[model samples]
Target: MPAIVEETVQPCPECGSEIRGDGRFTLWCAACDWNVDPSEPQPDAGRLERAGRVLARRHGEQLLGEMLDGSGGRPRRDVSAVAATVLALAVHAVTVVLAVGGLWCVVALGGGIGVVAGVVLLALAWLLAPRPGRLPEGRPVLLRADAPELFALVDEVAGAVGTRSVDAIVVDGSINAAVTSYGIRGRRLLVLGMPLWEILTPEERIALLGHELAHYANGDIRNGLVVGSAVRSLTVWHHIVQPLPHATGLEMIVNALYVLPRLLIGGWLILLIRLTSRAGMRAEYLADRLAARTASTPAAAGLMDRLLITEALGVWLRTEANRAALRGPRSTRRATDRAGELWERLTAYAASIPEHEYERQRRAGARRGHQVDTTHPPTHLRRACLLAGQSEPAAVALQAHRSDLIAVELAAARTEVARRLLRGVLDD
Candidate 1:
């Protein structure tokens, strides 16, 4: 695999040109004097230190609290971890109180139509009260528990990482993998993107699944989910209270009283969610480390290499391929069989790009800075962390039988995924 790896070149740190490598593992940037030793990758100690500091500031006491005796210290996963939930709950509690208070005030003000009108307004808010965001779903083929052939690989990976067993496995037409939890105590759903699966080797597959499943074991994604739900609930509350309530000429002025309170509380909730961005970046680092542990450093790094290539080149490749395939003879599930071939072509194309273009893309990705977003650290940072001082890819479950099982057992599911993909193309 490493023989073909020159196709996956690292971006030069100084100039972002494709790093030129000698026949034997020593990579140098022709455009810049950036030298990279793949065999002896350097750890960015600063990144690890920063991650530790964030964990200390936010979760140190909680990590230690679980070891102590009865109820003195904040319990593990105490108020801090779930503080967002507490704040949202507080908002909801206030909502209930205001609704009840309005009801009482209306009854005191009059015994006629005013009471009936107040009851309706309060009832409307009650009906629309915030719930956790519904888990994102699609009409993909679901792998049920009874499917042992499919569960075999999934269970092995989940068990390796010590994460909870997946409640469901879904195969989608997209090219990504994710594990998501919807609400408090929500079941975890695993989504395997078929196109992604088509391109990854079983080992690389482990790296991808391990990384996502690590999100589950680490409570990283759950925290994000809570933050999302809290934000959504706040938005829901704001919209409910901001609009003018239904009332006549003089009564309209009275109903306008709800606006200021909504604005103040909604304003703070927005600020708090933004502050949680730091925590999100920390979780990403931690999850990457966990993925390394499960999939081995080399496998994780390889997956990242392919991912970078895909990110840099996959969109155009997919659009072009889809357009061509629909116009070609082999346009059904048969098209997926050519995914590895497509990926190879794309990788070659990516490798052939001029140094300046590579640098421009790297600069574009780092336009704001090295941070990818609130949820992810920069790819460059993650690439360094994965490659730095790491062992060769872990060799496990690489038997031909396993690979064959993955392909044969999931054939029907993959067919469904391809069907959905083409259906969208046809609809368009």
Candidate 2:
């Protein structure tokens, strides 16, 4: 049985038709779609972040144009990409120089001021070192023994995508899913955001898995250890060298001392972003194509549809939590009861989205340059690329019973995430 939708009627701001929704989600006119999404677009903050977004969007548009022109597969190495790789190598060389200099100082000049300077240099070298990614603490780690069915499904998808199976699966409360490497051994971990997972069809879930796993096969330089650590090092250096605001006396002198180095680091960071933006965007397209090849075109395209609505789903979750928090004081219902209903309500809200709303969101995403993140191309372009790319039969599929078994495995994670989400709102 479906959860009952509690409707309230009000006049729309755009047109005088009645707007209806359950109190927990956005209410809009069915006739005019007034206030379908009331959230204002947030602009990227900081000069560097803004510059990166500009580069990403510009490159994304160019890639979209190439796809439209029927140019397919990985993009060729252009001048910018070649130059960016060179710069990345140069950044790594700096790290190596720092490490060698630190070691030489420690070994050759083994006393007093020399030792102190060597230690300082060594610390900086360690800070700039290429660290492997880590699995976040305080998240649920699902093991094969605990989630064999889920792991089996991921293994099949990995095979289909020509990538190794993830060593672990982590379930969290975010609105996104991702694959990342952890520890010195480079063990892969696939993080499944339950909020996003709950709303997707089983096929779309496979598509999501296929898409994430394909990143391993896509040769995305941005994710490689050398370039990734270089970017991190530059970011850290920029922060360290950035002048403090409203400095006085000694602080003012220190701020002035950093001006030149700050400018140099900032310029290099921006240049790296500009040069690599096209390659990064192309890697995303390649991942999407492999996802389609593994999960069938429709499933991959449907996953894009889910991506477009992520903002709406987030808004709805926040809205629902706020409503529940407010209602807790007035209503006779226990907070536990309200918390337990959150997952069900989320699924209901997702299912309740109409076809017109999807269209409206799609058009809005295109207009707003909506993307999964700065590293990926715009959502609309990714979707279009899926439709235009060669179609493949699904190499992996989720049977209904197997999906149910996986859901059973995820039961504890689901309850924990829901309680955490509700508690977050209530604590606020």
Candidate 3:
């Protein structure tokens, strides 16, 4: 007699439909159009399997190389790290020399206490520097893979590219996705957030995921972490000096003698950060290009456009929330009540503004450019770049909608600036 395999049936989460299971890892949902191996256990099992397959096929060679190279696949020498380190050492050496010279006693006895204060400030800054999060244990997981449609699409793309099965996928609540490395060998991981999945079309999602995979394929994650770690280590000496007490007048004078060398070295450290940020931006563009090449050009362009729009909208919402938070209870209550009443008014006001007017403003800003405010380039510039690469026919359509996207981004940017300014005022 042949052995019998038991079958299982479950209702689809998205729609009310019966789904038959083969007793393997399976996530079958008809309502939201999800179907994949029932045997795969995960929050969104099907999606994970699909993404895993895609990454394995597309980035297998690069991942393998990362594992073999170790040190997170970082180059042996980083000029920025070296320069920062040399500067930090020079600063320390000068401090030591000043301490040994008679200048230290003279300053302690006299009135140059500012040198001591500067050292203290530097120490505190070092101690307060942001620490990088620990790398995930295994490969990063792609979450929410149970949606059958998404899984199938991811699988199709992955199979086309020839990836091995992925380790796992995890979901975050935010509208973001990232590829991370973990463990001694630096296995790859894919993380997706729910908000992003909820908003983007399947093609856009794949493009976003592809962008992350490009990071792995290009060895950006490992190299980035390594470079960051080296930079942190080199700068940590500043923290070492923090516990020292305020210098006397004599000590202050000695410190002044060392200030010139310290300043020269510090300048190099700042240069390193600027250089690294510029390099990182270039890496982002490279990844964007790779994503465009791997996926269809139109899909990549759509993804970029959607991302900018979402970012802009999100920023606006956050800013409004912050403003509301800042108001007194009575004001807040009134604002809440008036929110509904103001909605239509605000909408109408927004509609009255000509679309081209906004685009003109954004373009002008891009041309004039502001000081680098964040690691990433302004959305307007990024969108312009993406639009430039689009084919003529597609570009026409994209340009037509550019105003809408810009409006959303501009609102968000303004909100963010307002919130930051408010926070600064409150802090003061």
Candidates in order, TM-scores: namely 0.64, 0.86, 0.43
Q: On residues 1-428, what C-alpha lDDT tens digit does candidate 2 reach at each position?
A: 26455666677788887665565455666576567556657766778888877777778878877765768476466787678788888988887888888888889998987788888888888887767888877778898999999999999999998878999998887889988778998888998998899989888898999999888877667766666667887898898898888999999999999999999999999988887778888878888888898889999999998887787787777766676568765441354445557777888878876665566666666666733368888787899888976677898889999999998999887777776676453111
State how far residue 302 of model 2 sits from its true place (Å).
1.5
Which candidate would rank higher by TM-score, 1 or 3? 1
Off-target runs (Cα >4 Å) in candidate 1 are 1-85, 98-128, 132-138, 182-185, 221-228, 235-266, 312-314, 321-372, 389-398, 423-428
What are the RMSD figures for all models against the true structure? Answer: 9.5, 3.8, 21.4
lDDT for each residue of candidate 3 in 1-428, tens digit (9 for 90 to 100): 12233466778775768866544223354345454222222232333234333433333334233323442232223564455445445544444454444344444544556556545544544553334544433222333343333343444444433343233455433446775545555454556543354445445555676666666555442245555444454456433333225888887776666566455434544554544543444445555655555565666776665554343334433555566668865655555555433324323333333333344334433433322223444445544554556432211112324434433433332233333322321111
Better of 1 and 2 by TM-score: 2
Given candidate 3, what's the lDDT at residue 246? 85
| C-alpha lDDT score of every prediction, in listed order | 0.57, 0.79, 0.45
When sorted by lDDT, best at the front, the candidate numbers are 2, 1, 3
With candidate 3 superimposed using the best TM-score fit, by how many Å does residue 171's alpha carbon deviate from the native? 3.0
Which number leads on TM-score? 2
